[model samples]
Structures are given as C-alpha cells and as structure tokens.
Target: MNKQLSWLRLAATLVTGALAATGALAEDGPQAEAGSAPPEASAASAARHCVAELAPVNAGARTSAIKQGGCYSSFAAAMAAATDNTVALASESSPESVGESDLAAAATRVIGIDYDGRFYSGSSFIWYARNNFGCFGGRSYTANMPGSFNNRLTSTRGFNGCTRNTSYSGFFQTGFWVRCFPNCLYIGDFMNNQTSSKRWAR
Candidate 1:
C-alpha cells in the first residue's frame, strides 16, 4: 500500500508540473511575454471551446463591459449590459481601430469579464492597449462608486479601467474563477486593497 501511494503521489506531482509548465496555475507570475505577438491557433480553439462552455456570451466581450436587466439571466447572457466608457475615454489616444485588431480599445472588448459583487459593489479593472499598452482602474465605494469608476474608464479610456456597475474588488482574489484573455488582468481588492491578476492566452 505504501509503495502504491508513493507512485500515485509521483503521478500527481508530474501532472501538476506539466500544468505549471503550460501556465495553468495562477498564484505565482505572468503567463506570457512582453511582446504584442499574436496568439497560437490552439489558443483560438481553446477560446471557441470556452465560448461554447460559457455560452450566450457570443464569443466577444469583457468583464463588466455591459449592464444588467431582464428576467432570469446569467451575467454572460446579457451582452450590451455594459457600455465602453473605456473606449470613449480613448477617443483621443487610440481613436481609430487598427487592422484585424482583436485588440480592442479595452481588453474587455476582447475578453468579456464581469464582477459578480461579493465583498462590495462596483469595483473592477481595465487595460488600455494603446500608448504602448497600459492597465489602470481602481476605487472603493458603496453602490454609488459605479459613476466614479465610469468617469475614470471614460477619462482614461485613452489609457485604463471602465465602470459598468456597482462593484468593489478586483477580479483577482474575488474567489471566482474566470477565464481571462489575451492580456493579463489585475483585479484589486475592495477593502484590503489586495490586487490579484490572471493571465489567459488568446
């Protein structure tokens, strides 16, 4: 029995090592590189698969880029629920949409991420891939904070985070597991001021 357990442990370790090698775990570091290189085909496949798995999403959008309403719906089901205040913010900086730019004004346009309020309401993040790519978004408040965060994403859309609704915490340590996108994202804490980020491929 001891020997059998040892072998099982070894197998588990090997699997974990392989996952770590493939950028599966999140607690440690950034997944990819600094280059704005395109994603792999396998990534496209994975993205599609994730889309079907996370359906009604229509395979394009990001965290809290929309608003919510209607009867009985998953957050992903409502597409236009968010407004790209971040995009408006970037009218001066990245005004024109570039060629084949899966790279939207904000990563949210590319990857639909949203925060289902837990600790607080109205807190999120955004990354403006222009001006050599910069990520910015932060604040903590009651449900009222959305207005402030909205102005922030709109103001810095040229450059960071946009507000869709009430939230107070980054996507990072929010205790919810979400599939991130091409770029990495850091969701700060509501009160503890903790910042956590996830790096997703494609």
Candidate 2:
C-alpha cells in the first residue's frame, strides 16, 4: 500500500510539471510571433515625412512669379511642400515617381494654376499618367500645364533678351491638335509656388 501511494504521488508531480511547461510555451507563442512581424507593418503605422530638393529661380529685372516655388527633383515633393504652404524649401524631392492626381482635390493648400512643359519637371505639378490614360484621350497630348495660362498670353523678354510667352493654352490635349496661343505658342507662366521654368520653342 505504501509503495502504491508513493508511485501515485510521483506520477501526479510529473504530470503537473509537464502541464506547467506547456502553459509557459503557450503564453510565449503570441509574443514571439508578434516580434517576428514584417517591417512594412510597422512602417505603415508611422507618419509620412515630406522632403523635397529645390533650386533658385534667378530674375534680374522682374521678380519671379513662382511665389514659394523653385526647382524640385520630383513633382511629388514639390506638391507636398507647396500644399503645406510653408516658407522653407525642401531638402530633396520624394524618391517616389509622380502619378496622375486631381490637383484641385489633392492640392488643397496649393492655389490652382496652369502649366505646360516638355519634360517632367517643367510644371509646378506633373501628372504621372499619360493623356492616353485619362478620359480616353479626351484631353489629348497633354502631360503638364502652366499655372496661370487660362488668360491671354503676354510676351516677355528673358535675361538674354530672348522673347518668351507669358501665357499658353490651359492644357495640352492629345489625339488632336488644338492651339492655345498663336503668337507665343509654347511658353507659359510658372505662377505661385513655382521656382524656375525652362525655355521651350514649342
């Protein structure tokens, strides 16, 4: 009888120890899984920081029309800085590529302006999408538009005494040809929040 009682006690103690070990593992399982989660999950929870690269727009006679605007490495960074309406310049343009977006809606803080350019950096804002992408080419051959070209264009002289257009067609249309300005066809204004504009013979 004594031997049997001792055997039963030993068995109970062993079972209890095994159960405690299992409980400990169960408790640690969730913590270990959580620690192994992907880094992107943490990044998604963090706030987005806006930084842009900028350069000066030099004007010897007339003050530059691009108020708070300048050369940005990328369009996305430019819009982020201008939308904030802060006076400080950006350190670098966002590495992300610019995409097609509704300026009026996305650029709540930025004033509405028109722009047109051959290259991506030509306008204060550049849509990432091609004209063939939006509205099935209803807005033909358009990529970028100037800020204030909705009005009549004026002829202005640059530093080298070369003539440039003060205004241009509102936006470039693709699929079909539409003339926005007759005398000064290609050049346009880089208005508020823009930095510098390149000379285009278009």
Candidate 3:
C-alpha cells in the first residue's frame, strides 16, 4: 500500500513539474523571440525600406533626377536636413512619376507623404513615405514641423495645399499617400500624387 502511495505521489510531482516548466516557457516565449525594432531604428528603416523598394516607371508620365539626398537614418537627422521645397518618398510611394531628369522640376514641388490618415493645420509637417522619406515643409511653417518618428506623420494639419488639381492617366494613384484641403480635408486616398500642393493645406 505504501509503495502504491509513493508511486502516486511521484506521478503527481512529475505532472506538476512538467506543468510548471510549460508555464515558464510560455511566459518567456515572446520575450525570447524577436520583437519590434527600437523607435529610432524603425524610423530609419522605414525610409531605407521605401527607397530600396523604389520601382522604375515602365510606361506613363514620369519625372526625373530624384537624387537620394544624404539618407538620414533618423527623423532628427532628416529634420535637421529638411528644408523648404524638399520632397519625401517611400517604398509604398516613390518618385516613379518624377524621373531622374525631372529631379530639378520635382524638387520645386513639395511632394509630402502621408502614411496614416491624420493631420492638423499649421502644426504637422509632410511625410512622403511613412518611414520612407521626410521632405520639406510646404508653407511658411517649414521650421514649425515635428521630428520624423516611426515613418508615420509629422504634421497636425492634413498637408500643404496644391497649386492645381491636374488630372492624369495611366497610373490610378501616386504610390505614396497624401492629404489635401480647400476647407481642410483628408484626401490621401483620392488626391495623393494626383494634384500639385502648395502648402500643408493639401
């Protein structure tokens, strides 16, 4: 009888030990596995990723000479370098429409990027590619923009306004995202890469 009792206790202890081991493993599984990159790393990586994924324009209206400015690894770095009349690009949205030769012409165009669908007037800056590119400020508030972070957005307003709404064909939308406004509207979906913006009003 005592032997049987001893056997039963040993079995229980073994089962308990196995369960405890499993619980511990479960608790540490995520921590042990790879996690999201650091914030600074993520931001830098976004721009790099976008630039790396730049697809060549096969057949359509395209610009030229979009040089890879000093690839700033961080938004702080990009912001420090960001000036008025600069343009941002990303993996999701790149300079396919604007070619290498068109770089000069495209440079004058403040092609900001809007990764997410959010903006505020006269507060946020423009985002060309979420983490991909951080370009110049559209309006007089170029110096009032925020540091690029997570390749998301840096503006409180939708975006700078466009000069004219010139409609084109071939490409449905500009690969990148953007926002526009006559009375301050978020039109990144319908108006991205489709029109010319002036200030962050677009």
lDDT per residue as tens, model 1, 1-202 = 9999999999999999998876744434454443434566333222210010011112333331223223212212222222223323332222122212423543233222322223211223322122222222332111112332322211111112223222223542243332222111323333333223222222
Top candidate, metric TM-score:
3
lDDT of each candidate versus the true structure: 0.28, 0.32, 0.34
> Model 3: per-residue lDDT, tens digit, 1-202?
9999999999999999999999899878876556768777665455521221111122342432133344444333333233333533332332112222323323333334332223321112333322222232322211111223233332222212322212221223333434333222344445432332222222
Each model's TM-score?
A: 0.18, 0.30, 0.34
Ranking by lDDT: 3, 2, 1
Q: Which stretches of candidate 1 lie over 4 Å from their true place?
A: 1-86, 89-121, 131-195
| Candidate closest to the true structure, highest lDDT | 3
